[model samples]
Target: MSDKQESIKQAAIALFAKRGFDGTTVPLVAEEASVGAGTIYRYFENKEVLLNVIMQGEMLRLEQSFKENFPYDRSIREQFSHLFIGLIRFSQENFESIMLINSHTTSRHLSDQTKCDYTSLLTFLSTIVEAGREQEVIDRDLPIEAIVAITFGAVVELAKCFNGGELTLTEDLLETLDEKLWRAIST
Candidate 1:
């Protein structure tokens, strides 16, 4: 992508994260990106197109963060730790991206491909939960979807707290949160 396109993407993600899809407009994105409205149109056909592209890119980035240096040979508990830490790291580094993703994954403006991409990210986490359940490490009473939802809900709320200035996300705090989330889902 050119510098202009990247700037548009970054601006749109931040605006969408803060104001949401319906609240945001193409002209607004162009203003935030320091470009003309026509420039945004030159790159993205419409606001929906831009939103879908941003969602797909952000989802792919998140999935890659979990996959990077993932410990396949480790015990399920260790694997969970790795994934949890990966999420924390990604959220901290790309707060706007995470905010946009969490808020807009179910937007009516999302394309089918964007929905599929989001589902694939969930499937990756489900695979981990399924493995843990099979190994008798995670709670078997809960469905895979519930387990993933619980974990994500906890972490996402924690991220919100941190972003809202309600809590300081120190290393010690993160470790405690990770352990607490693990115990919540584990047997």
Candidate 2:
């Protein structure tokens, strides 16, 4: 990203954290970015497009973080720990971005362009399932598609509860849910 693009992202992150995806507008992002409206348009055709780019970057960052922490030499348990723990840590670090993702997912205004950018998350989770299957930690017959859906749905719903202060994001919670998640995929 150019310096300007980075600046825009930073501004958008703060704004989205504060006002939410639905409440925020392109004009607000342009002003916060310290760029003209035209500049924002030059990079993104509209608010939905800009929001999608932001979401894609956020998910990519999460995937990269998970990859970095999943040491190849780790035990299968350790590997699963790394995967789940990495996700929780990433969520804590990027709470705002996660909130924005949730907001956009529910937003009545979300465009098709914005929704398509979220596909990487499914792929990332599927890779984790595949790894577990290869390690025989997860069920051999557990289809990747089904496990991916289960993981995604569980994470999103649990995250909503956590974010709403209805539940904790503690390590204990992660460990318990990790077990549950594994059980769902295991034989």
Candidate 3:
């Protein structure tokens, strides 16, 4: 990220977090960034483009963090736990940016790559349940698709809780989410 772009992103996030997207404007972002209004135009064609870039940036960061920290060699259960914890850890440290990025995404104008990018919790997690089945650690009768959905879906909601300041993961929300998720999916 260039120095100028990063500064603009930071300012934009702070403004959106405080005032929401509808309430914020390009000039406001520029002023918050301590840059001239024209400078923002140089970086982004419009507010919508800037918002998409920021959202993509957040997903890339989380994907990088997960890719780096996850233990590929661990057992399915261990890996599942790690993924959930990783999300909470990443979100706790990056809530402001993450929340802002999340707000910028909408149902329309969302690319397939971007949709798969920010919220692939299900697709990535179904693999874990499948692994457990292969290892004979999980019952084969359960449907992997629904299991993955319920497990990962709840974690997403929990992350929302953490982001909203309604819940704090005192002992790693992953541990709790992992256990509860496993119980729901396992026989």
The residue-by-residue lDDT of candidate 3 on 39-93, one tens digit each, is 9999998886776677677777876776676788888777867766776677688
* Order by TM-score, highest first: 1, 3, 2
The number of the candidate with the highest TM-score is 1
Off by over 4 Å in 3: 14-23, 101-105, 111-123, 133-153, 160-166, 172-174
Q: Could you tell me every candidate's TM-score relative to the true structure?
A: 0.97, 0.68, 0.74
| Cα deviation of 187, candidate 1, in Å | 0.7
RMSD of each: 1.0, 4.2, 3.5
Better model by TM-score: candidate 2 vs candidate 3: 3
TM-score of 2: 0.68
Return the top candidate by lDDT: 1
Task: Give the per-residue lDDT digits (tens) of candidate 1, residues 1-187.
Answer: 8999999999999999999999999889999999999999999999999999999999999999999999999999988998898888788888888889989988999999999999999988999899999999999999998988887777687788888899988989889988988999999
lDDT of 2 by residue, 140-178 (tens): 786888876676566667766777789878777888888
Q: What's the C-alpha lDDT at position 46 in model 1?
A: 94
State the displacement of the C-alpha of residue 11, model 1, in Å, after optimal TM-score superposition.
0.5
Residue 71 of candidate 1: its Cα lDDT?
94
